[model samples]
Target: MTILITGSTGLVGSRLLQRLLEAGYDCRAMVRGGRPKPAGAHAVEGDLFDTESLARAVEGVTAIIHLAAVFRTGDEALIWKSNFDGARNLMAAASAHAPHARFILASTSNVYDKSQARPGCESDAVAPTQAYPASKVAAERALCESGLTWTVVRFPFVYGDGDGHLEELPAHLLSANWHPAMRMSTIHHRDIATAMVLALDGKFDGHVVNIADDVPASMLDLIALSRGEMTASARPLAEPWAMQVDTALARSLGFRPTIRTVFHAAEQQLL
Candidate 1:
């Protein structure tokens, strides 16, 4: 089936595009700012602000993996336009052109506030404190309210080779050793891509699932794993960012990820 992927050049989107192409699926990539599209995929150049451009991108596509969104630290307006409005625009286009197609929207676990206890589930209340998470919540709401066939995958921090966050963690740790003891949930980028493909074929429809690896590590454990030193004394944040996702939903649907494999992938990239 033809699958249209937004943010085809990003860390997660690029990897997902490669995997989808390798699997012999017809892939269409929607990109912004005239960036060159990856080979072996149909490239559709357009901006999210332009509804007509977005409609053209979704036309004739069987499925859509919505991954395009802003993740900047500042600039609320840009974040809102890119994350919330952009997502709404795409959803509207998909509803109009490909309403029956499987639409997978990549959301984040950060939609849960810091006050949330560990092992957050899909049914947990959404309390987005940051602009990024707020935008994701807004996007999720829009998709759910649109009455279209959609699945929202709330992903934890994804890391793997060529990941910008993995590369910067060492420097961020070394500079101030401000290693808060926050519980970090991570999934390999490959796993995220794999899950997306599985969800497309799986029985779960119009449901939200939390996609993450089996193991959840604290910041201290991550530092030890990354730097080979357990002496970094950055206590865990009082409001730890721990998420014990009920993978039961995904598991019941026949999806599981090897946490060890993901960890090894991150280690290879970090060290």
Candidate 2:
């Protein structure tokens, strides 16, 4: 089967491409100019905003793993265009070219309310406040309402070696010298890639799954695991804190990872 992955050079996309190639699947990657393509995947150079290029990328592909988007801080308008509008363009292309292709959207757990009940389920109402989360919600809603087969996976604090987002956590903890005993969820990149492939191959369809590790950790626990100490003034983020995800959906699909493993993996990457 031919699987097309957007943002093929980004952290999750790159890892997913590696796994797809190892599994002997025909993989096509969408990349920006000047970026090198994964060795085994077909590289298509184009911007997500470019409709013609997006259509070309989707043409004849069996499935699409939509991972491309503006993730970090940026101008509000630019972020919306890249994250929301880009998703719209990709969906349009997918509809026209490969309507039956299983489209997997990489969403975030940030869509849920910050202070949610433990083990948040897929059916819970989304409450995204930040710009990034808002854009992701918009993209997710578009795909769900679109008359196409799609699966949305909501990731909760994925961490792995060379992850840019995880790298920043240490800085925040150090600069603020603050920590709280708040439970948090996380997953390894390898597990995420594995789950994505499984979702594409398995009986799962049109479902929003929350992917996370087996255990949750407090901020203090994570700091200690990283071999760092919290200052006396360290404090936890206010109420409406991020809660754990209900990975029961993911587990039913046969994917699991231990929190100890994830924490150690992140420690190796951070320190």
Please report, in order, the local distance difference test score of every candidate based on alpha carbons. Answer: 0.78, 0.78
**Candidate 2 — which pairs collide?**
114-240, 115-240, 178-234
Clashes of each: 3, 3
Tens-digit lDDT track for model 2 on 76-140? 88888888999989889999988988888898887878667555788888867778889999998
The digit string of per-residue lDDT tens for model 1 on 1-271 reads 8899998998788888998899889999988766887889989887788888888989998888999888865898889888999898888888888888888899988887656676777888887777898999999889889878888998887777566665455556667444456666778877887688787785557788887777776666666555545454544456654544556787877678854544666556532
TM-score of decoy 2: 0.88
In Å, residue 92's CA in model 2 sits off its true spot by: 0.4
For model 1, the superposed segments whose C-alpha errors exceed 4 Å read 173-181, 228-237, 240-244, 259-262, 266-271
